[model samples]
Target: MTISLPVTVSPRLSKKASRHLKERFIEFLLFGAAAISVFTTVAIVYVLVKESWNFFQHVPLSDFLFDTQWTPLFDDAHYGIMVLLSGTLTSSAVALVIAIPLGTIIAIYLSEFASFRVREIAKPFLELLGGVPTIVYGYFALTLLTPVLQILFPDLPGFSLLSAGLVMGIMIIPYVSSLSEDAMRAVPMSLREGSYAMGATRFQTAVKVVMPAATSGIASAYILGISRAVGETMILAVAAGMQPNLTFNPTEPGATITSYIVQVALGDLPHGSIGYQTIFAAGLTLMLMTLVFNLIGAWLRKKYREVY
Candidate 1:
């Protein structure tokens, strides 16, 4: 065979090669960014499960689940999750009741009816409301809302689920309204025009065509609102009294799972003690609850997802 000479790369080919290498490098960077979230999630699950497993080994799953009280810090040491769950559910329910309808109405107004000037003015204020510190909301709940509620209902306590939940609802309103408005606004203009062509009013078009087209996004907003309500800590801790009461009545003072965790985490409970381990167990439970809600959200998104 004849001697083979090394092929010389043209300037164009060299540039192309450099560009391809850069593209690969960029792809690797993007993948690393994506993987970071996955890694963090996995690590969190591992730690929670490992610590919670230790907790379960010490405390029977039956008592953890079925006991009526949650006095893990006391000498009696009851570990019923239901008490915390009840408070969480009650507060979340109250928050949802206030948030969903009002958020939806606001979203519809902003997306479909509000003038551009009004929308521009309102959105920044909504964002600012969301940007306010949760601790501030907690104090506001404690100092302001409770007294107002007490005025309305003489029996309402200074630290009540109703006050905490109401404030939480207000706090999460921007989350729901902002996301839902974006989803609604994303609907194609052609759909609105077609509805008008069909003699449908603006309200009708917004309600029927645009809403259906944006169901996936609106559902996502609702899901985010639910997660925010469920996971709220400071507001409940400062205002809901952290009593671990197993009552669904929002008028009563109670502790949510999150508030209890915060209490134990800040307390002088010794490491490896059962009382301390309770936080890990509670953390695991919260993660699972959030996971279930996420799965539900995924299902809703899939079920109502529009091609457009």
Candidate 2:
């Protein structure tokens, strides 16, 4: 006999359905937050590129590219890109030097060597370093770091690339350590166990087996960290003076592309002037630099990504 079932839901059942709807709403909001990031990137790129194209139209490409001088306010000048490029490369290279080894080793130590209790305590503290403001690092570089550097190298200038680069390096160490640690930790415990079972010591197993396996992840972290170092502005502004000289002397004062724009933007350069356009051009250059690093990081992740 077929019996008709009554359409009924208890209060508890209805409440559960409401809860599921609320949960879905929250999940959707979180995904929307991620979507906004892509929008932000696009907006910034549009502004930079649009204004930069306007700049290139007015300023001759040859003078901006081949000229070895940059005097936007002077009677005659050459706004060559090499000077700012030098500053970016200098700071980034110095940071890479300090970050790669320190970050990689710390990552290894934290993931493989530190006790469980130690790791629990260490990770948050290490990540905290990365969260510190870049401006604070800049201040520390100018006031604290500069004085110490002067004592160490008497001939060095007060505000120079050395001070900025070193500060930037210290600032980025946390990023490298934290990200690389995650990569190293992703390796299966079984891999380490197998290496150990083959009579390898902990360090040997880490270097010979685990590290090699996690190479792609580490490389990706390194590239991303490099990108951070390159794009950093505050430290360069405070410690590295705004003098865009075509020299690689770390002891000499020099300006990064960012510092130059900041200097110009601070009412010194009026809107719609050729000088104003210079900033946009500089922004485009910086954008391209960042894009290059991002591509490199992506390539590394794809090429060396480990499943296990």
Candidate 3:
């Protein structure tokens, strides 16, 4: 004989509850997405470190560091990392020399000088250039660029770092120019107007006022270009002959750490073998090199960051 009454939530309160639940759901989704990337990066680093540790166990750290020859596959294996390091450095140097100056100039032109019509038309072309496969560029370097280089200097080998580096620079030009131009264009128009009021020429405004204001973003672009140059694989693999030599000569054919890894990866080396383990060690080295460059870039950005 109990009298029971049901209690119901008000419409407003129910609606608010629903909204709160939806917001939490969206936030959780975003958090999950971010966590995926972090987890993947951590997993990659763990694998590389684990395998590299296994490699170091078999090869002494001193010999790996101090050796001048890299013949890990040969019967008398010598693990001088410098042989690959030299090639990597030389090729990267050549690429940077071409990319930095050219990309900066292109960015300045597009950002400051190009009309709206020209900008619209040119941007797509630049993006298209970036989208082309790296393998096509590799073959172009081998078949076309190498022949052209031979005409200029007959002593230039068919498969040399110069050919590979030059092509790689061209391939990455869009990456540098596009990012740099975007950074430059992001500079406030008021800054340019102020420079003009101060009797600065268009070139002066672009070079001095705008460029300094956009330093952080431009530094980021340069860093991306450096990373691209350092990590380029097929162009160096197919164009630069896969020969391990400890020399900083771009005109000569040599093997980079990347090319060596590719060679070993495509070969039938058994898993867990010493030769197979070298790829992980080389990968760790490459990752360290990229990390150093990124740190330098970060420092540059911090040192030159502009609030306005």
C-alpha TM-scores of all predictions: 0.91, 0.88, 0.92
Give the clashing pairs for model 2.
69-78
Which has the higher lDDT value, candidate number 2 or candidate number 3? 3
lDDT of 1 by residue, 120-193 (tens): 99999999999999999999999999998899999998899999999999999999999999999999999999
TM-score of model 3 vs. true structure = 0.92
After superposition on all CA atoms, how large is the RMSD of candidate 1? Answer: 3.4
Per-residue lDDT of model 3, residues 225-273, tens digit only: 9999989999999999999989898999999999999999889999999
Over 171-190, each residue of candidate 2 has an lDDT whose tens digit, in order, gives: 89888888888888899999
What ranking emerges by TM-score with the best candidate at the front? 3, 1, 2
Looking at model 2, which ten-residue stretch has the lowest summed lDDT?
A: 70-79
The better-scoring model by TM-score among 1 and 3 is: 3
| Model 1 CA deviation exceeding 4 Å by range | 1-34
